[model samples]
Each structure stands twice: as C-alpha cells, then as structure tokens.
Target chain A: MGRYFLSKLIQSLVLLFGVLFLVFMMVRVTGDPAALMLSRNASPEQLEALREEMGFNDPALVQFKHYITGAILGDFGNSLHFKTPALPLVLERLPATVQLASVGMLMAIIIGIPIGLVGGFTPGSVVDSIGRFLALIGQSVPNFWLGLMMILFLGVRLGWFPTFGRDSWNSVVMPAFVLGLPVMGQLVRLTRSAVLEIRGEDFIRTAHSKGLEPRTIYLKHVLRNVAIPLVSVIGVQFGYMLGGSIYIEAIFAWPGMGGLLAQSIGWRDFPLIQAIAVFTSLIVLLLNLLTDLAYSIIDPRIRYGR
Target chain B: MSIILQVKDLVTKFYTLDGVVNAVNGVSFELNEGETLAIVGESGSGKSVTMMSLLGLIPMPPGKIESGSASFNSEEGLCDLLQLSPEEMRDIRGGQIGFVFQDPISTLNPILTIGEQISETLIRHKGLSKEQAREQTIKLLSQVGIPDPELRYKAYPFQFSGGMRQRVVIAIAIACTPKIIIADEPTTALDVTVQAQIIELFKELRDALGVAVIWITHDLGVVAGIAERVLVMYGGRPVEIAQVMDIYKDPKHPYTLGLLRALPSLEAKESKRLKSIKGTPPDLLIPFKHCPFASRCDYAFDRCWEEIPPLISVGEQHQAACFFDLEEGGPRHD
Candidate 1:
C-alpha cells in the first residue's frame, strides 16, 4: 500500500508539470495581455511603459522561464487586474468553492443513492420509472438555467432560499443544487444500473440461498460491490463539480474561486487564469489518485506496482 | 436412509419476450439423507432452474414456479418448499438447505472477506455473534482445506485461487451444518486437478458432516467419482433414475446410453469414436406433447413421438422414461 502511494505521488508530480506548462502556454496565446489590460485612451508611450513594467515585451519563452522559476519559489506573479499574488488570490476563494462543491456533492449522494437503489431493486416499477424520469430531467437541463429557475421560484417567488450570494446555510442551497444536479443525475443512473447488474451476480444468489433478509442481502452483499464503481464516479464527478462551479458561482454571486475566475476572464487577468487552471488541475489529479486508492479499498483485486 | 427431500412435478417456466418457455416440464426426484445424488444434463436442460425454483431463488417476473412442491424434511419439519413464503424460504435456505452455485469466480462476493461471507450465514441461521461466527468460520476454512485459516479468513475472494474460492464457497454452504448441500457444477469453472481436489474436499465434508448432497453437473465422468444415485435429465425432464452403477451398466434410457457412450473410456481396448447425440436439445419455447428426447434418440419410434413417456420401474431400483426395451430389442407394451 505504501509503495502504491509513493508511485501515485510520483505520477501526480509529473502531471503537475504538464498542467503548469499547458495553462501558461494557453493563457499567453489568447491575445496580448498588456493590450487587453491597458485603457484604449492611453498613449503608445503609456502602453509601452505598462508592457515593459509587466514584462509583456519579453519573448514568450523568456517570460515563461521567469514565471516557472518564480512559481517554483511560490511566486505565481500578481494578478494583472487585482494587483495581488495570483496564487493567494486563487487560494483565498478555494475554501468557498470547496464548501459549495462538497455540500452539493453530499446532497447528491444523500438523496441519489437511496433513490437509485429503489429504482434498481424494482427495475420496472413505478418508483424506478419516476427516479429515472427525474434523473433524465436533471441531466438534460443546463446548470445555469436550473440555477435561474431555482433563484426565480425558490428565492424570488417562494422566498424559500436567497437568490444570490452565499452567507447562511440556506443561502448556499440554490447554487449547491445547481452545482450538484448533473452529478446527482449521473449518480442515480450509475447506481441504478450497478444495482441491476450486481443483484444478478452469482454471489447474490448465494446470499439468497443463505436465507439472508432482503434488507441484509442488499445492505451487506449488494451495496459493497455497488460502491466500487460509485466511489470512482463520485471522485471524478466532484472534480467536475469544482471546475464546473464557475457558472453556478457567477449566476448566484457566490464568492468562490469560480467567481474570481469569471471576473478574471472578463478583465483578461492571465496570471489569475493560469493560477486557477493549474490549481484545479492539481486538485483533479489528486482526485484521480484518491479514486485509484478507493478501488483497492472496495476491490481487493486492484493492485498498484507493488 | 430416509428421504430428505422429495420434489414432485416441479413445472417451472419462463415468460420470455419470444414466448412462454417450458423450462422444467413436470420434473420429480427424491434425495436420500447422507447420500450424494448427481443430476446430470446438457445446458438448458433446466437443471439449474429446477434447483433455483426449489430454493425460491428464481426471479418472479420473467421466471416463475408455475406449479410444484419440494417437500423437504428440514429442521422445521416436512414443509412444502414451493408453498413457503420468501421469509419462510429464507429460514430453510441457509439453515437446512445450503446451496453452492456454479462458477466460483462469480459465486463468492469479491469485495467481502472470506470470513465475513462464511460467518454471515452462521449469524443469520445459527444466531451466532460476530466473535463466535468468526471463530467458527476459521474452523470451516480449515475444514474445507483452505490453508492458514486465521490469516486466510481475512482475505477477499480475489486473493484466493479458483479452487480456493470454491473451497470458501463450500465453507459458506456448510457453515450452519445444513441438512442438505446443493452444489450446482461446483467444479465446472476449475482446472482438472483443482476440480478433482474440490470433489475430494466435497466428499470429505459430506462424510464428516453426514449431510445429504445434490451434486448437479453435466459430466458423467464426474458422477462416477462421487454420486450414489444418478438422475439423468433431458429437456428438463428426468429421463432415467438409478444407482450410479446401475445407470452405467444397465442403462435403460437411450439418452442415458448416448451420454455414457459420449464419454471416452480408457478401459476399452479399441479406440471407439465418442458418440454424439444427433440433435440439439428440444426448444424449450415449444410445449412438448410427446417425449422431449424423441427427436434425438436413435431408438425413437412412432410410440416414442406419439406419447410422453413416464418413469417406469425397469429393475429393483432402476427407472427409465422410455418406450423401447433395449435389452429385448423391441418396444415394450408394458
């Protein structure tokens, strides 16, 4: 297990380099950073001064070398728009995004699993049909539109939840639902199909032959096997939730990295863009590692190099 | 020995998208206490379905127990298994009548530890606490020939080899000292040496526990190793029933003879080409009005195709469901 962890750590470190380089190159390619940042009324001399100050006049490779070296020393350069360290700016909103994303994923899991189980258990029954129908609607509807609908109805009309911004626990509900909806749909479908496939497995027959209670058979025998696939999906979906939170955060005015990213994109803040992209990709790589570890936990057959 | 189980006219069917499949057509057999009865048949002969139906393990929607009675002399007394509710069936299932399915790789739960899988049955049926179940499970592991009972108990199914997995499955089946163990092709998924070992292990467990065993397999060669009585099923019907020796020596049914001939024998001086039964098994979707094996039987005649043959006494303890008297070279009016 320790060996497996070490290998995965090495793998993630290599992947981190890939993320840093890709984001750096991507942000640079999207038009001139100085031109996008400076005012139109500024004279050529003023623009040149701004470009020289920001080192935008330097060759791309030279600038990348400076950025990479600075990044190694925990200096990702200041955000062009905020005029603060890009890494710190991204990290500041990290907790909010984490909070919203986790709460949303938790909500999806708490409700989706039981509903999916029931649907899978009965298959063609009424509950199964309804669960599948709701999952379909959840998957098809765009997250932004769903957020708007929730804000209009639950927040504006019903006064059940606040329309925009995160403050109280209740305030987080609308955006969290929007964030979790697609993931919840995926969970429902995967869980249902998993249950359907697993219940027919030879071991389940062995369980039934043993005369275990319906509840016990499902809980002990069925659920453990089902969890293997579901855990991996959850890890991946959670990563997706983090990246996809920008739209939800923007729509709801939630103060998170996603909101920072949205505002940064509008102002063409390349450093902030690079920092957020690198940070989220790192998180995704970590999530992939977690998912691999989870496989060994649920299925003994999966082994690392060791 | 007394009869432990008597399954009468077990007619199980499947409601398929194509049509109603006559899977098991009025099958009947009896298992004696402390005896090994092998049910031998080709695939889709409804051997597995028959066992599943008796255990109440058949899925109700597509597969249904159309009509049947499995009068098992369980700990709860002589109860008709078919008449029992799902809850009642559960009580007898792991308690009195344990079942080991085919395919060891798929039979044991991969995620669960061998100890947990084995002990869960003991907990449910014997009311043993976790510690007690764990203690007994380690003993069962040793009993089923799984080495290092203590360490192996904590191991998962994937950790074990195919033979070891089957041993774990056997341990679970015999966990509660069930009155009967139903092993459906337990060695089919295993290698030849492993298969022999599993059969040997099963024999040892059976002798030690003195529990009745219903060993289901398609291998006639396998039947020769462990079975006391052999029940030959063709197209979901028991075509012949007799002592293992009798079935092999004085085989009355043409299908049984064909099965025996299909097996290569080292005892024969000349290498005889192994005979293959001419036709495929009768389509289960069609309702059989006559003998199901009539089309395939070389000895099949007008009477064979005209009427459904019932199991009739051919010798003191042998029965055959056929119209022709192979020994006399004529169709028996009797």
Candidate 2:
C-alpha cells in the first residue's frame, strides 16, 4: 500500500510538470502579453517600458526558466491587470470555488445516488423512466441556460433564492444546482449502470439469499462494493466542476477562482491565467491521486506493487 | 426423518423482450432433515433457478415467480415462503435457510474482509453481538479448514486460493447454523481434488450441524457420493426422482439413462466413444404440452410427442415422468 502511494505520488509529480509546461506554452502562444495589458491610448514608450518591466524582451527559453523557477518558490509574478502576485490572487478566490464545488458535488451525490439505485433496481419501471428523463434534461440542457432559468423562476419570479452573488447559504443554491445538474445526470447514468451490472453479480445473490434487509443489502452489500468505481467518477466529476465553474461564475457573478479566470482572460493577464490554470490542473491531479488512494481503502482487492 | 422444506408447483418464468421463458415449470421437491437432496441436470435445466426462486432471490419484473408455495419448518411454525411478506421472508432467509453459490470467487464480496462477510450472517440472523460474531467467524473459518483463522479473517477474498475461497464461502453459508443450505453447483469451479475436499467439507458440516442440504449439480458422480435422493431435471421439469443408488442402478427415464451412459464407467471395457444424449433441450418460449425429452429420447413413441407424461411411481420411492415400461416392452400411455 505504501509502495502504491509512493508510485502514485511520483506519477502526480510528473503530471504536474506536464501541466506546467502546457500552461506556460499555451498561455504564451495566444498573443503578446504587454500589448494586451496596455490600453490603446498608451504610447509606444509606455508599452516598451511595460514590456521591459515584465521581461517580455527576454528570450522565450530564458523567460520560461525565470517563470518555472519563480513558480517553484510559489511566485507566479505580478498580474498585469490586478497588479498583485498571481499565485496569491488565485489563492484568494480558491475558498469560494472550493465551497461552491464541494457543496455542488455533495448535492449531486445526495440526489443522484438514490435515483440511480431506484432506476437500477427497476430498470423499466416508471421511476426509471422519470430518472432517465431527468438525466436527459440535466445532461443535454446548457448549464448557463439552466442557471438563467433557475434565476428567472426561483429567483425573479418565485423569490425563493437570490439570483446572483454568493453570500448566505440560500444564495449558493442556484449556481450550485446549475453546476451540479450535469454531474447528477452523469452520476445517475454511471451509478444506475454500475448497480445494474452489479445486480447480476454472485455476491449480490449471496447477499440476497442471506436474507438481509433491503436497506442493509443496498447500503452494505451493494453501495460500498460499487463505491470503488463510483469514487473515481466523483473525483473526475469534481475536477470537471472546478474547471466548468467558470461559466457558472460568469453568469451568477460569484466571486470565485472561476470568476478570476474570466477576468484574467479578458485583461490578457498571462501570469494570472497561467497561475489559475496550473493551480486547477494540480487540484485535478491531486484529486486523481486521492481517488486512487480511496480505491485501496474501499476495495481491498485493489493492491499496489504487490 | 421430518421434511424441512416442501416446494409445490413452483413455476418461474423470465419475461424477456423476445418472449416469456418458462424456466422452472411446476417443479416440486422436498428437502428432509439431515439429508442431501441433489438436483441433477445439465446447464439451463433450471436447477439453480428453482433454488433461487424458493428464496425469493430471483429478480422481479424480468424473472418472475409465476406461482409457488415453499413451506419451511421454522422454529415458530410452518410458514409458506412464497406467501410471506418481504420482511418475513427476510427473517426466514439466512436465519433458517442458507445458500452456497457456484463460483466462490464471485459469490464472496471482493471488497469485504473474510471475517466481515462471515460475521454479517451471525449478526443479522443469529442476533450475535459484534464480539461474539467475530469469534464465531473465526470458528466457522477453521471449521471450513482455513489455516490461520485469526489472520485469515482480516484478509480479503482475493487473497485466498480458489479452493480456500470456496472454504470461506462455505464458512459464510454455515455461519448462522441455518437448518437448510442450498448449494448451487458449489464445486463446479474447483479442480477435481479441491472438488473432493469441498464435498468432504459439505458432508462434515452436514453431519456436525445436522443441516439438510439441497445440492444442485450436473455431475452424476457428485450426486452418487453425497445425495440420499436424486432429482433429475431436463427442460425445466423433473424427469425422475429416486434413491441415489436406485437411479444409478436402474434409471427409468430415457433422459436419465442417457445421462448415466454419457459417463465413462471404469467397469466398461474400452469403447468406441462416450454416448451422448442427442438434440438440445426444447426451447421454453413455446408452451410445454408434450414430453420435453421426446425428441432426444431413443424410446420416444407417438404418444410421447402428443402429450406430457405425469410423474408416476414405478417402485417404492421411485418416480419417472415417462410412458415406457421396460418390463411390458411397450408404451404405457394410460
């Protein structure tokens, strides 16, 4: 188990380097950072001064070396637009994004699992049909439009929830629902299929023949056994939620890293954009590692080097 | 000996998209106390389905129990298993009745510790405390011949060998000391040597606990060693029921005879080839109006194709669903 953990940790480091390289190259290739940062009214002298100040005049390899070294020390340089350290600026919005994503994922799991279990339990029943219908709408409908609809109905018309900005517990509901809907849909499909497949497994039959209560059988025998794959799905989904939060943040005006990302893109804040990208990728990579770890914990059948 | 379980007119069908398949058509059998009743049949003969149906373990909607009444002699009284509520049925399950499935690797949960899997039955059915159940699990494991029962208890199913895993399956089955254990081809996946050991273990557990077993298997050799009485199934119906030795010595049904002849007997001299029963089982999609084995049986006559034959007593405690009479040398349709 320790060997497995070590291997996964090493793999994560290699992946982090790969992500860093991709973010650096992708951000640099888009356009000149200095020209985008400076206003149109700025003179060539001002632009040159800004370029020199930001080390845009340096060779590409040299600039990359400097950026990589600074990133190692947790310094992603100053944002051209925000005029603050890019890393800290990204970190400042991390909690909000984390909050929204976690709550959204929790909502997704809470709502999706029961529906999946029921749908899988009775594949052709009315409940299954309704679950499939809900999954279709959830996955097919654009989240932004759903956000708008949620805002229009529950916010503007019904006055049940606030339309924009995260403040109270109730305020996060709309954006979280919009973000979580797709995840819920995906989970419903994954879990239902997983459960359906698991239903034929001999262990499930053994559990049934043991005469356990329906609740015990579903939760203990079925749920935990299915959780290994489900954990990976959840981890991947959360990583997606973090990245996908950008649109939700834009629509709702939620002050999260996603919102920061949108603003950085608009201002061509290369350092900030790269920082956010690197940070989000690292989070995704870490989550995958955690998912692997969770597998060993949930299912003893999964082993490392041994 | 008293009868422990009585299954009457148990009909199970699978409603697939293609059509409804009569998997087990009016199958009736009984399990007596301290005796092993082997349901012998080839694959798809509905032997496993009959056992699963009695436990109400068959999935509804797709796999439905059309009609059946399984009366089990519980401590409280005789309760009709088919008529009981799901909750009541659950109490009867694992508590009074246990099951050991084929493919022990798949039957045991891969995620759980051997102890956790075994102890659950004790906790659920026997009302044992956590500590008590843990102790009993180790004991059960040791009884099934698992080495280092204490350490092995914490190990997962995959950690054990196929035979050892089967022992764990047997341990789990016998945990609550259920009166009846329905083993569905429990040794099919094991090697011959391991199969012998598992068979021995079943006998040991049976004798020690006085538990009646309904052993489902296709191997006639296994039936000869373990079962007191044998039930031969073909095309979802019992073709013959007789004492184990009687069925082997004098098989009344042509299908039973074909099965016996298919075996490579050591007593017989070197032969050209092993004789196999001709034709496949009749498709269950069609209504079963005629004898299921008519097309496959060599002695099948005009009346065999026209009507179904009822199970009739040919001798004391011997029954065969056929119209042919060996002594009379002709079909006895009436």
- Alpha-carbon DockQ of candidate 1: 0.83
Tell me the tens digit of each residue's lDDT in model 1 across B183-217.
Answer: 99998889999999999998998999999999999
Q: What is the TM-score, restricted to chain A, for candidate 1?
A: 0.91
Worst 10 residues of 2 chain B by lDDT: B325-334
Colliding pairs, model 2: none
How does each model score on lDDT?
0.88, 0.87
The TM-score of candidate 2's chain A against the true chain A comes to 0.91
lDDT of candidate 2 over A101-207, digit per residue (tens): 98899999998878888998888889888988898888999998989988899999999998898877888888888889998998888889989888778898888
Local error of candidate 2 at residue A163 (angstroms): 4.0
Taking all chains together, each candidate's TM-score versus the true structure is: 0.94, 0.91
